[model samples]
Target: MPHVEWRGGTCRVKWWTGETLPNGRKRYESKGGFTDEDLALQHGMDMEYEVRHGVNITNRDGAMPMPEWLDAWYASLDLAHRSMVNYESVIRVHIKPYFSRHTVSEVSIMDHRAFKRHLADVLPSDNSRQSVLAVFSMAMEDAVNAGLRKTSPVERHRRRGKYKKKKRERKKDMPPGAVETLARNAHAVFGPAGYAFMWTMACTGMRPAELYGLTREYCYPSWPGSDLRADPDEADRYAEDMLRYGKGDGLLPAIRVERQVQYKDGGLQFFPPKYESSRTLVVPPFLAEMLERLLKEHESRWVFPSISGGNLRSANFDHKYWRPIADGAKEDEGPRRPGERLALPEVPAFAGKRLYLIRHGAKAWLDEDGHSRFAVESRMGHEVPGVEGVYSSMTVPMERAIMKSQQERWESLPDRLGDAIWG
Candidate 1:
């Protein structure tokens, strides 16, 4: 609503600015010096209408420079550490560089498309470009809510699945044999911890963060017992409750996934699993024994700490440990010296594939076993969408079936009792 009042014998127009003052009064923008009261009243009404309709760019925070807005918006976000990192990268590397001279409201649709083209030229894949653009679109949409822009320049119709492009190749699961091969390779590189780490992740379908975050208390046949609570009796009771009441085999080993690790502020930090999907995963008999052995031999709080004996940094592990295991260690520079040749042949099954594929492989194995969709997805730390997720549940039969299938797969492998590949 707008008001016209006489000020110093001239008409003045005032309207609420859609903001409240510090004193809890309505903030207003006013213009004076109109000799005609009706004219002043009309002008105030027009301004009010524009403000109400989101056509007024003069509102608070509407004209901030793009770079400043980007920084402020980023600082205000409460997101996952990894997601924040990606957003920061997209803004710093792509957005701020191009839109540095513009205000939040000044990026037109043409500019948005051009910025996308620029990203296409620089980013390696369509997915990369899309991810970056999604970040920018989110920022612009937020700007509109903050009265920084009337509308986002990013077109919603251009988003993912708006048009079909190409069908992606079906990813293959790592069979028991391939998993063993990777374990052998990991053993050669990281010793027993490496061997067990590969097997644990492959068998459990654990995300890299989840696997890195694994601790002894979460491991089965041992968990709740390994808990370091001050009250030992409480732990004992909890253990009894968990062990005494399940179907199939009450003694079946399981891993309770309560948290995951990620790099935050230059240090490793524990966070709830993605989407807050804290779940307990059941493992096969062989995996249960494997994890128990690994825990016995494991020295650190982490099931698989980095070679430096600290919390595992994903990047460092990927480069130093995983790369050699998957791609095989090439001849080190010492090869140039007289007798310092050192190399490890890469595993063909994992050639050029990322470590996360191990999770994919595990999920694939569960699906191939023809278990209940809910059980499979739940075990993989994913929620089945829609009402199905609400009604469907993991039963003891489903869990037992999964365990049986995996054990059978293990039994099918040759050389099941072979000597260790590496010390």
Candidate 2:
């Protein structure tokens, strides 16, 4: 039962919370500042109901500081290395400075509101502010679970329009004939291995990290046999090879995308692909032939290794090779300032495009071929929601359709680029 009384020109409700201390002292909770007795009593009854439903209301003494709680909560999380890196960055740069000294219970709704205002003023992008707020909210939720606070202040702030809709960004995709042009130019500028790498990405829709992770062991090509055909009964053999060699191939040389290379802790690290997008994608026959040639020439373990026979880093490749080829040549002008010179270059039609646009173009090609939604999504490593995703598997017909469509695209490249590609 809850009772309301008039106090300081406002109504206050008193209620007994079902909590006891070490010394057998019962805890009573109170809420104040209601305009009338009815409202105060109603709020009190709700609080009492929450207490009866096993909500912890004992630790409201502002004892556990936020920094300590955040550290413990972070340590307990079983997150990926990349996700953990983002969490650590948010905690150190945005969260700790503001809330480190304040106890969990002292962070009231008003304080949360103030923090949002501060974030709006200081942060340049809405996405950054939202990310910080999200991590802070998670930390507060952990505090509530630990009996350090009665309720999360973030929940109250959420109801007051803390979240606003952001303008969606338009997807960047390459135009028609762009992929073939880029691949032709890449071969001319960078060499045969670069040509194979670019064509493989465009044909298979693999992420840059996945491309970096490709190895000879994961490449299943129908080579050493001139007909480029796999034995009809080789599926079981391939499965056994996968168990022994960590990667196996089918009749057509398919690439198994089971891992990705990421930069962490000042070095490179290999982890499972994003969202565990582990699937084998059938390669276009012509592209498969090119990859075989590349492997023989390189004589390295990796399917696409750097000049030094090491794992290729996307950043280094982009800055040194991709930017120059995509953007074309530049001539430096006279100095505009004491230490600066102006360089003007004739930009190509696809100047600002990124390597990722090639992957998007691959998906566009699949969709244009009228493949089933499940096939497209699975090939792109996207999880389709609902029963369709769980019940459906990529069938042989789907893989064949994808392979045929991609092969057609590869065969048409010479016509699209004329002498630039065929020469």
Candidate 3:
């Protein structure tokens, strides 16, 4: 039993318990006992709080093993299968081996410093550190929520800076001509499968996941209370009619956000788009007609169905197909500047280019064609947070108008800029 005694104006507390700690040594938990009763009482209160609340009395107090706490945290999480897999992967590959034996509450400033140093010194890439930090923060948050610690130690850490390459302004975006040439080449290489996929991405700005998730059931032909174009052949005429009469005196066309498709569970599940606002977009006659054509031609229940008639894997689509096609086209197109000196004389002319160039091309066209940021960001489904989100909704109609105009600009590119990029 621990003992406490007061003598004169001083107080002394002693630990007489014979228990050994994990390191197989006795712990007094105190030394040079308080000379005042008030200080002694406060220490007693702190000790009680530590016992009841599991709060770390000090950073080096040695409460529980890091691996044990991490395991408990993992077991408690109600997360998706993919999310759990990712979390387990990060903990196993990064956190466990380094921190497993360390006591959770006893982890010192030195340990943290070492962790940061290890990340900086030996991490294969900047993203590896970022991923580790993300998992560490999550686990620490769990500790706080469970009342295991007063606050997250992991919260005290931050990445030094964004990756250096990320800090640089991205290269100038590809022009529309280059995008079409690539699309044309993609069509030639993969036939309708590639052409349709590229065109859908270009027109909708939908992510690959969203493209793969598109279900026929979610494709709505008519906006609310809007005229239904039952005949796909007359969609163009119907679009013109709506433009002329849907709004008073044909002054401004009635916005017809005709259809949308969404993916859930990374495209394993399909659903209607949640981002749809009350506002609608005015799609052009050509696009409406194109959609009509696509709907008529494709018999599958998916707009952009997978090769196996299921959702397409994003990696397979990009690597097995997109890269090869883009690289081949780049080879056929020759060097960006004729006889341009390059580091890899042996690398095929197309070896270094990325499929992301298609996305960049669309953005460049949208910006150059005078489309507003609101329009582009909305089309891209970027959820700008806080006040920007409100402003986007208020100004989204102008964005729709700009997008309509941009689409017109895209339609014209294949003819005007065809030779500039392809030749």
Per-candidate TM equals 0.80, 0.72, 0.63
lDDT of 1 by residue, 291-326 (tens): 667667657887776554566665377766777778
Residue 185 miss distance in model 3 (angstroms) = 3.3
- Candidate 3 clashes: the total is 0
Once superposed on the true structure, which residue ranges of model 1 sit more than 4 Å away at CA? 1-48, 51-55, 59-61, 158-170, 227-241, 244-249, 330-343, 416-423
Measured by TM-score, the strongest candidate is 1
Best-performing candidate as measured by lDDT: 1
User: What is the clash count for each candidate, in the order shown?
Assistant: 0, 2, 0
Clashing pairs in 2: 220-253, 221-253
In candidate 3, how many Å is residue 216 off? 2.3
Q: Order the candidate numbers by TM-score, best to worst.
A: 1, 2, 3
RMSD of each: 6.1, 7.3, 9.7
Per-residue lDDT tens digits of candidate 3, residues 1-423?
Answer: 345678766676654223357998865554335787666766655665565554534333346688888888888887645467678888887788889777776555567668867878868666678778888878877766765566666535356545555433245445445555555554444344445566545555555545565544333243222444544985675665444323233333223333343334555453333343212344444444444455566577665544444445533666655564565533434222223222212213223565554555556656776666766666555666677667654253564565476567567764732233222
Error of 1 at 356 (Å): 0.6
Q: Write the number of the candidate with greater TM-score, choosing between 1 and 2.
A: 1
